[model samples]
Target: MIVERLIIADNQPLTAYAVEALSRSVAQEIHIEDLEIAYAQNKTQLNNLLRDGKKTAVVVDYTMFDFTNQENFTIVCDLYQNTSCWLLLSEELTPNFLRYVVYQTQNVGVAYKDASLDSMREALHYVMTGVRYISQQATQILLQKAAEAENRRDELTHTEREILKAIALGKTTKEIAADRFSSVHTINSHRKNIFRKLGVNCVHDAIKYALRAGLVDESEFFI
Candidate 1:
C-alpha cells in the first residue's frame, strides 16, 4: 500500500520530532513519498489536509490536540475514509479512552508517545498497511481492565446474576417477581443487591455490566 501523505498532528515538539524522524525512516523503507508535517492545531485544519481523499497516514496525540473528546477525533477519522491514524498516547491517558477509541474505529493504531523507536515504526507501518496495531503498554491496559471487569462479574451471586440479566432484558421488577413466584418486595431487594454487588447505582450501569459480561445479548435486550 502506498501512502500519499504523512501528517504529524502532534503539538509536543520533542515527541513530534521523534515521530517525524521515525516516520521518515519507515517511509524510506516502504517507499512512501510526499512526507510532510502538517501541524493540524484543530479539527478544521486536519479536515482540510485530508480533504483531497488521498491515502494519508496521520500520527496524532489526541490529548494535546484541540479535539473535545475521543469521539470527536473518531468523527474526523470516519469522515476521511482514505486516512488512517496512529494514536500517540500520553502516560496519563485512561483505559476508558483507549477502549473507546480502539473499539470505535478500526483504522487507528495505538502507541505511547514514549514508546520505543521500533514500536513506533511498527505502529506506523501497521497504520500505513490498513492494519490495527496496539502497543504492549496499551495492550496491558486493555487486558487489565478486562480482568477487573471479569472479577467484578464474579462478585455477583447466581441469583443476583439472574436478576441482573432479567433487568438488562427489560423485565420489570413486578414481572420478575411473578415469574419467580415471589413478591415485588423480594424482587426489589434482589435488584438492590444486584446493583450493590456490581458497584453500580442505577439500572443503566447494571445493564451495561450485564451486557459486557455476556449475561444478555444485545439483540435479546432489544427484543
Candidate 2:
C-alpha cells in the first residue's frame, strides 16, 4: 500500500530533517509534512492536520511524556483505524512499557532514536504495509508479556492460591491443613487441583509456579 502522506512529528530539529530525507523517496510521490514539534503533545494540531491531509502515516517520536502510554495508545489506535503510526522510541523506555504499547496498537512500528537509518527504513517499510514493526529488544519485551500472560492463565483460585503460597513456604499438606483449620484430605485435594491447573506434577514444581506467578518471594525458596 502506498503511504499518501508522511507526517514527521518530532521535537528535535535534526532528527526531523533526517526523517524527511529518509522518507524523500516515498515522500516525493505525494506529500510529507514535517512537523517541528511532537504532534502527540498537541492533540488539536494533530487533529487539524489530519482533517485536511490525505491518507497519511504519522512518524513520530514516542518520547513525549505529557501523554501517558494509554493516552498515546489511544492516539495510535485512532490513527491506525484510519492511517498508521511509526514511532521513534526512547532508550529510557522500559520493556514492560513497550509491551503495553504493543498491547494498544497492532498496525505500528517503532525504533530507538539512536538506531541507524537502515533500521528506521526497515521499520517504516513494514508499517506502511499495515504490519507491526519492532526492534529485537521490543520482541523480547513482547515475549516477556506473553510469558506473564501465561502465568496469569495458570492462576489459582483463592483457596488454591493460599495453598500454593503455603507450599512455597515449605509447608507440608498436614501443616497447611492445621494452619487453615482444614482437613488433610481437603488440603491434598486443593494441592491436586493446583498441580492440574498449573500443569505441574509435584510440590517442588508447584512452588516454582508460585514463584514465577509472583505468589511467593524468591527468598521463600530457601525456607
Candidate 3:
C-alpha cells in the first residue's frame, strides 16, 4: 500500500522516524502537508488545507495548538470530518481524553511522545493497516483511572446514594418519599439532583450506570 501519511507534528525527528517505520511503500512519501504550528499563524488556512486534503492517515500531536481545548477541537472536528485514520502523538494521555479522541475519528491510534522506537513503529503500522493501536501504557492508565473514578463514586452523599439505590431498585417517586419519611416534592428534588450528579437523564439510564459503577446490586433486593 502507498499509505499516504499527512503529519502535523513539530518533532521532525520523531515524525521522520515514524515515517521511516511505516510500510516500505509509505516510507518514501512522507508529506508534512501544513505543519501543526502553522495553525498558530492562521488556523483558517491550516484547517482549510487539512479539510481539502485527500483522505489518508493524519498523524498529529496532542499538544499541537492545545488540541484538547474546545476551540482547537472545533478545528480537529473539521479536520476529521474531511479526513480519515488519525494517529495522535501524545504526552501524558488520560483515558477520558483518549476516548474523546477515538470518538472523533475512525481507526484511531495513540502513542506516547516518549515511546520507544518499537512502540512508535507498531502504532504506525497498525494505524496504516486500518487497525486500532491503543498502546499498553494507554490501556493500563485507563484501567487505573477507572479504578480511581470508582473510588470517587463512593464519595457521593449518603442521602444521594440512598436515593440512587432506591431508583435502581425501581421505586416510584412517591414510594421513595414515603419510605424516606419525606414528601413527594422533596423526593423529586433529590431525584433531580441525583440525575444531575450522575450525568444521566432517565431512571433506567441511572440504574444502568449504578450497576456499572457498583453503586447498587440487583441481587440485594427483597421481594
* Best candidate according to lDDT: 1
Q: After best superposition, candidate 3 residue 214: deviation in angstroms? A: 5.6
lDDT: the better of candidates 2 and 3? 2
lDDT comparison, 1 vs 3, better candidate: 1
lDDT of 1 by residue, 1-223 (tens): 4566778787788877777787788878887665655667677888888887777778787778898987787888788755555555565677777877777787776888677767877888877666678899888988887677668788888888888888998889889999899999998988887776665567876788898899999999987
lDDT of each: 0.77, 0.65, 0.62
Lowest summed lDDT over 10 consecutive residues: which window, candidate 2?
A: 32-41
Please provide, for model 3 over 159-206, each residue's C-alpha lDDT reduced to its tens digit, 9 standing for 90 to 100: 988898888887899999999999999989988887766545578756
Error of 1 at 105 (Å): 1.1
Ranking according to TM-score, highest score first: 1, 3, 2
In candidate 2 the C-alpha lDDT for residue 116 amounts to 75
lDDT of 2 by residue, 95-167 (tens): 5456556655665666777777677777666554445678876787667755754565446689899888998
TM per prediction: 0.77, 0.56, 0.59
For model 3, name the residue pairs that clash: none
Give Cα distance to truth, residue 10, candidate 2, Å: 1.1
The window of 10 residues in a row where model 3 has the poorest summed lDDT is 32-41
**Model 1: runs farther than 4 Å from truth?**
157-160, 172-223
Candidate 3: Cα lDDT at 37: 22
